[model samples]
Target: MMRRPGLALKLSVLLMLGVVGAMVVDFSLTSGTDMDRARVLVFVSIALAMALLAAVVLDTLIIRPLVRLSAQARRMEDRGYAEPFVPTGLDEPRELGEALEHLRQRVLAEREELQRLNAELERRVEERSLALAAAQRALVEGERLVAVGRLGAGVAHEVNNPAGVILGRAGLLLDDAATPEAAEDLRVIMRQAERIREITGALLRLGRPSRGERGAVDLAAVARSAMELARHEAVARGVTLELSCQASEVDADAAALEQVAYNLIRNAVQASQEGGVVRLHVAGSTLSVSDTGSGIAPEAIPHLFEPFFTTKKLGEGTGLGLAVAHGIVRDHGGTLTAENLPERGARFVVRLG
Candidate 1:
């Protein structure tokens, strides 16, 4: 590609061409003049002066201002908009420089405003995240205390009956020593103590935080067992039990999974009305227990997973079943949620990851 000449070079070339044309015209017009040589000398001097003047004019008006503007642009690119463009020269170049300066200031202002907005956005996000985390922690702690209170009450009630039996039998034995009835009394005492031990053991197991003895557990089998356990309760309530499950496996404790399934199924059965149906559906690692009965109260949905927040009658439920099931599923890296069905009744879904 042919390189384009700069302004200065092009102007100088035009000046030289004009001078040569003038010399040719003068020589042609004064071809017969006796003072031709002097005339040529005068013409040469004037041409040289004009050329020098043109060079000065071009340098001052065009060349210098453009060079300055280019340097200012480079500096702005390298060091940012700290230095402002100072207009110089007369006429067009100066006007152009002023326009560039105005544009630069506007851009800088917009950039600063953008940075401020970005900082504000980040601050708001962080604040919301912290607040959300704190709220979640408080909610979890509150639920935990409620669970403890319910467990304590249930334990006390369960232990009280067995304790009374043991104490009464011991008193009878003391009153009738060496009697044939004393042996039977001793045996009854032992049986009541064992019952108390079993109740405590169950509580301990439910309260345990860790998922016990992980293995590849067949979810279909667990669902079957849970259904079988709840079958009697469903029958007693005149409710039908329906199961739809595909064979699926998960890394979990078989006993823990069984407990979760049983608790959920039993709750569904209890929630159902006479002649209603409780359906258990399992697909992959997800299980849903749904019942055709009155849907859950909207207000109670939020506290459904909380301990001692049951809607059942006082004697019918201790309110710890769902809480225990929730904890067990959580320990196994899963989630359990309850939601009222669209048409009627409620559904409990468990998803294991």
Candidate 2:
């Protein structure tokens, strides 16, 4: 209803001053006795009316609207997401109000989506990781079986020749005995034959063929027997068989333990050169066969228990020795590993888990 407060206030102030000056001028113009009292009263009344009008305009238009808008802004800041703001006047200020409200909604939606995606991705990664672990375990078991099969072939192949020699020689001596000294020679031949048979028997106990039955095995006794058999071989090669052994036992079938020992010893023997030492350390409910010959490469060590993976030449070996030991150990709830010695040669470590 009234003019703007700033403009009205300025006009009111100017009118008040002009009225005072006009009163002064009229009084001066009428001389000291004229006083001009009626004109002065009219000017003063006009000034008062303008001042009252200016006060009304300030309250109704500028001051009251600003106070209401300020209260709305404070309410929106305090309770942002719960409600929408009332539409105010247009311009940059109006756009700012709308943008603030929409910004809250967008932030809330993005926060929710981010949490959901993080959970989903974490779940998928865990599942994939478990599957990979299971597959890796299966692959390792299969490789172990293949290794055992190859070692079995080497033992059978090497054993057959020695058995035939002892058996043939003993049979001839038994048929041709003719004197006391000859009889003693025949006795020696007979004993040698028996020893050879015992060796094969020990091996058979540890290396069960498809046609054989696996029964309760004594692993400790079998290990001792294998150490006995390797002793002579080590001496003949000018190498000392270091038996770092203590009394130990296993519930495995006796035959399998012998083969495990045999495979380990054989690898140790091959690793060492003449006069080099091979250590047969048995403890911790486990056994280790080590030799000082040629160290294995790091790359080769990983595949040492793999079937047909031999550092030996094709003609010299079939690469099943360590593999067979690994399989047999696993069958007895154990593990087998091969590595190069720090100084020289390779070491076979077997453990029954």
Best by TM-score: 1
lDDT of 1 by residue, 1-353 (tens): 95334211112324322432222222343344658657766776677577777666766776688779988898887799978888888788899899989988999999999999999999999999998996797568556754774576567567767676776767667666786677776777766566555445445545673447899998888989989988999999999988898999998888888888888888888888899999989899998899998888898877776666778885566566777788778778788888989889999999999
| Candidate 2 vs. true structure, TM-score | 0.44
* Among all candidates shown, the one with the greatest lDDT: 1
Q: 43, model 1: CA deviation in Å?
A: 57
Cα displacement (angstroms), candidate 2, residue 11, comes to 43
> What are the candidates' C-alpha RMSDs?
13.3, 13.8
Off by over 4 Å in 1: 1-202, 209-211
- Candidate 2 lDDT over 189-261, as tens digits, reads 7776666555454344335432334555445556668978887777777777777676676556566667779
What's the number of clashes in each of the models? 0, 14
User: Mind sharing the TM-score for model 1?
Assistant: 0.51
